[model samples]
Target: MDNMDFSSFLNFNTVTVAIAVILLILLVSRSLQRPANVPPGPTGYPYVGCIHLLRNRNILEVFRELRGKYGEVFGLKIGPNFTVVINGVEALKEAFVKHADDFSDRPGGFLAEVVFKNKGIGFSSGENWKQNRTFSLSTLRSFGFGRRSLESRIQEEITAYLDVIEKQNGKPYNMKDMTVMAVSNVICSITFGSRFDYNDVKFKQLTSLFAENFRLSSVAGAAQAFPVVRHLPGDLFSVKRLVQNFEDIKEFINEQVIEHRNTLDKDNQRDFIDVFLLQQTKNGEENPVFDDLNLTTTVMNLFVAGTDTTATMIRWAILYIVHYKSVQDKLRQEILKVVGTSRLPSLADKPDMPYYGAFITEVFRMGNIVPLAVPHGAKKDIHFRGMVIPKGSFIIPNLDSVMTDPEVFENPDEFHPERFLGENGQLNGKEKIVMPFSLGRRACLGESLARMELYLFLTSLLQRFEFLPESPDKLPSFDATLGLARASKDYSCRIVKL
Candidate 1:
């Protein structure tokens, strides 16, 4: 071979060596980038990143107990997933309030994708979520949710509840079905333009189905603990059952949708379904975002949100009022003072009914429904507190700790309504430890509607009947149980007519 041929071969070899060196450098840089700014967490096992901790739901409490060892901000593992939990009131305030934007997006996971389906305002992200969330708020406002105009629906509902209780004839009656039925029925008027009787088997079936689906969703179990297992069909987990429930829900919604479409009046729309159908007709199948699926999910979302939270809270409210008769008397006095005995109390009387208002707020704070709210995630990389919580890291803001913080409330555990009272002996509104509706951009869309219902129903009932335990030896059980939100375990209460 000639010298020129040898030089060409040597040049080719040198270029190849240079390319290999550059590739090696790039690999190292990519590896270092991941661990960089990643919040500190306990070392997790392979494939099941944090699945082990999730298998043991007590991990949250364990972390709290071992805070001295791991510190306030620590990591949780479920398979390959990483979650950064925020403990105590200070941490909650800092993350949820101070750094609200950074940790704003709702977290996504196996259950989030398959079970929740990321459709409604609760779990969805991006433009779809913002539009739906905004529309829900606007619709609630259009209905006069908090204002006097909206008070008519609440007044009607309140009348309905009073009538139901009066029909019991002051006998010992389970308030759960009655409470849920009445609250859900009011929402029915608002969302479906129809009401179902408490004794109606179909209504019971619907509620039962929802409850069963909720019960199957073990947010703290193997499916949530290990994402891989969630997609798999094995009785090693109930993931298949979870998928089955979703299909069941879809079928039920389809039946309702057919009925709704059959009788829907596009010209004068009333319920939420009517509004959505109108939009669908206007947009058509060509419209990608809005469709029948979205409508069913959105309406179902409204019904579930309204029914579950309001019914549970009302049950708690009565439990507390009965347990503390003085508070009940004060509330009744306030109601009578403002509205008198002739007509029932309504949302119009809330401002004058400060004591009543404070009592309800106290119900929220005291009850402490949903100890830790549905976890949120970081849309983009976020630098918060003293640690760096990476993008997609599951963030748990322990709302339970925040509500019961000693620094925030005078007596954290006690059922005290006066804590919300001002120096003027009215609702202070400050020292606001309660956050049952959640906070910031993702706050509850039905907040105003729920508030109106709570005020009207609670105050009106106090004016008419007094809630009491079934027997002198019996007190309403305060055991907390889970169904996304915590409520009195085996949730039951009794009532008496005035």
Candidate 2:
């Protein structure tokens, strides 16, 4: 061989050996880096961790596949973040309930730093979170959050939405915006003491921003997992868009807060905003938790969370009923038998409608919205189930795993309401098995309100209208476009008055 050719071959071989040596060193170092009791997981690449595996994969599907290989508790390194996913009911309860404080803090990363900023009750942590959560829950409860007193306001929106549907004249129409408006109005009433028209310019702008935010926030999850990429230009990913969305939402909320401040009455509190204003005034300069920033973020939290989630579930309910004719007929039959057609359904009627309750339970399970419940943080280092959860490590309680556990629900994949019903056809409190609202200390605060909305809205519609797919043979796809919520694809159904 020529001398130059021989030299090139030698150089190539030398480079190859160098790469191999570096990789080996990296593998060994990563193995050594694991603390004593670290959870088992697939070994990721050097620096980037499992980012390559996660970049384009469906996160829920990835978690499910990982659960099969690593059991209920497994660790994943995406970018710079090391996250431990706790799947199934027992593991979830063990972490979130038994060891609540350790797993209660919100994980800090790009999302927390940028979008959330640890301001509101939803994602804030420590004593600030505790105080805000307690006050907000109490304030909401006083304003008829879980109690029967709040039913009238919800029923008002239900009646308004039903009128809109009835005006559709049984023709095919997309239920997305109108349905969201109906649900959002309840939140508006509670927070701002009023409801916006479905077509209001500002209201539409707000919901539109919220919808975009939901999609972008899901994208932000990647940044949370791998904070290294958070610095990249906004044009490359949704993080930039997510930040803008929050700004817009917060601006709207600030405007509302200013309005409430202008008309504050010491002895008279109309709704949540008034109560907050009073609290802020009472605290004056001393209270850090009741200021304008906290108020804006909390209001934003209530709306952004309250609107999309319950509305999406209601939309899913209609889609399920349309896809399964028997379920639709049975749900309608139950509604008729329980509440009758003379007047609107109320919370009082819920106990008598076991099938309805059971159906809602099945919907929560099948909807699998929030497939991975909002990521929690390890408040401190935790030794859980023979694994070490490092302080500040992200904790994901896979509610989907619990809801669909074969032990908890037979044939979990199939959409069967009967699984939630007892042998005697009564709702046997099996709804507890499906936790769409999450659980323990950090569980959703608006859960009671959401539940009441779902029952009243679904029952009201079924009492007056029968929903059917545009084509009897071609039902709307049960498949969801996943994000923070599993929203069904936009589909039009004929809402024939019965």
Candidate 3:
């Protein structure tokens, strides 16, 4: 009887081991499998996915190569997350514009989870995003965004910027700090109802934090992809620093919010904070979208999204203008003819100066600052272009592909502003395809403000100064250092007062 019982126990153990093995096999296979009918590309390893392909390679170059292999719509699984990269103008427009609702959501990752906490317009989605976006847009328009009414405020910052530059006395000086200071101050004026002094310790610290966080975000993207990395011992991916920087920024913004709340006048709204505070009162604290946290996060989004991108574009403009002296000369001639040396270029002059318009278009096209243009997410299971874009996949709009498409821009490789100009020197409609600000519902909230700043600042700068390389033989490198924004390498230029 004892021998019989031992044999029975051994049989039970064997059955249990066999079942465990089968389950293990199934789990591994499940991890390796791709969702049916998703866009086709590399079927990378489980968990890590195609992230290995990006190591030590330019992301743009990698995407271009993948596009060559996988067509316009391709898929990449990055660390358990499925990402779909959309290339070509038609595909992009279809995905972002035609199927706007399906692809209007923002992806959740380290950025949404840690940095933004799904509070702000940039990273948040659903009704919260819609309400905040709608309210912000309406409020911004009322305060002269995308209108000539706000140009005076911008011009005030420009006046201050030019004074700082003039103090340089045409010496070799990197315009990065001053440019960021000027650009950030515009957002400050809109948000805080005032601008900070250039030399103000807090202002400098705040701007530096913005710039540092921008750089760190690119590194922190790893943590975004593989969240496990964020939990590792050291801050290898800069996640800790990024979070700390964000906290510091939030604290600063929160201080402004507190001050605004105390001084807010319901009848006389001074700025964005005042407007938001008044709305908060109307909605009451229980309202999810207009709460204090959302207010701070939204303002943080404005400063972060607004400051770096516009400033980087300005830097790229300066670099390109100096690199292409002929383009610079022509731009100056147009400005001189229309706006003249006596006063800064105005929006009225913008209509008359097609060349200058084309030049800006070319800069937008060539600079491609926000190359990926903030990743979008599939709101639901989307059937796009005969493929299944599974719910929660990261949707990347490759603006670089559209901007640099040979078919769209003839000889897209060359830095020719005339591509945007017709034979009659009018802006050819090709500028419409150059979507540096991206497209559709989740398009940049600060688009109008950015465009206005770019036009005014660049026009005014060219009107006042001739940007020359540090030395005749040492022109700044045109190659951009890839970060959250494609930034121009640090290069000083002699800003000869015109």
Candidate 4:
């Protein structure tokens, strides 16, 4: 009996001790969690961390509201990563400009690692980014980027695009397909040395793939935010679809590369691809950066950046001008006075046309394309305003905050071009008011080309026709299909010749 009692006591004591240890561990973890210096944000569940807010709300709207609730700089635990969002002018300037080197690194997650593999300029970091960016800038410059010489190629494309539109014969049509092709052709010319026919099945497939990637990327928001979730199987976030899209894009680019290789001309380089290939040969074994993979990704970067974003803005431009007839009328009057219908508008005419310039600036502002801008990562722990922004934290410079600041623009909600206009009806020096392309080290590399395209395309179109809604009673919805780029909802319009 004594032995039995002793054994029972020992078993009970063991069980009790184990329970106490587990509880103590849990308590200690809870106490030590997150950091005191981390910016305050909404309460989140373990592991997932504010994913519900991400899925349910418009991310930009959520960030804007959070800025209201938790001050200009706040923290969000997106999955496994702790993210820091900087809103307003002062905070953005500090993070992006002042602490550029510290804030320049791209975040490492499944998106940056598995999908992108740190290959191209947009997402890559450190030496890879430095090499690729320098080469891209110099190579593009050699091809007459940002110069009047490049304008001729764009004008040829413009003429080709205008011919296609003319075939519509004043009838109502959805301009999305043609417009995407037209804008893509400019980059295609520079990269592939030729543009696809409007009805080319392969080209159509490529555009569709690009659009699908954008949708999937936005859908992959949670996975990107919380990279731990990417390891799990099943297409819960459509991650598999996103990967497949990337594969397809690589295949398309590789096919082009193979063709270019077969017809090599080192001395008389045809386009960006030829130049890159020539460099690859010149560098040979010593070059670590200029690989075929880098070539593929850099070209992909150029196409996606040059095509979708610019095309989306042009689409928005058409919608806005149609919605606000007076804006269109004023734009047309300027173009007519500056460059008559007898000849196409030239880049030289830009200096003489300030109202048109203001209109484009307002379009960039009101369009709110690329609202959050590309995500920036902290290379090291950054101390700002009594907060320690942990190393590897995802840095979001809230561009929406800057574009829609109430103090900067009176009545921020209204689409008002006059805000950018001066008393003399010239392009006011309010260039800082809009930032559709983000600022600092990570500003869009294709900015010069995109600007030239927007100017020539907008002026040319307005000079030729009046864009009117298919049904004046019901204008196209201004609401955007929120994704990587904020694209306007599909709508039809009639192009009446001026």
Tell me the whole-model lDDT of each prediction, alpha carbons only: 0.71, 0.83, 0.88, 0.84
Candidate 1 regions with alpha-carbon error over 4 angstroms: 1-37, 40-72, 78-80, 87-94, 97-101, 145-150, 219-221, 231-237, 491-494
Best-matching candidate per lDDT: 3
Model 3, range 1-498, lDDT digits (tens) per residue? 598999999999999999999998887688678778999989887788887898888889999999999999999887788999999989988988998888889988888878888897889988989999999998888886433256788998999999999999999999988898899999888888888889899898998998898777766788888889889998867789889999999999999999988887776778888888888888987998999889999999998889989999999899998899999999988888887788878777778989987888898988989889899988688998899998889999999998888888888878888988889989979888899989989889888889889999999998889999999999998878888888878889999997
Ranking by lDDT: 3, 4, 2, 1
Candidates ranked by TM-score: 3, 4, 2, 1
Which is the better candidate, 2 or 3, if ranked by TM-score? 3
lDDT of 2 by residue, 142-234 (tens): 865443257888988888899999999999888998888788888888888888888899988988898787767657776776666668865
Candidate 3 — which pairs collide?
none
Model 2 residue 159 CA deviation (Å) reads 1.7
lDDT of 1 at 482: 64
Worst 10 residues of 2 by lDDT: 141-150
Model 3 lDDT on a 0 to 1 scale: 0.88
CA lDDT, candidate 3, residue 359: 87
Clashing pairs in 2: none
Supply the TM-score for candidate 3. 0.94
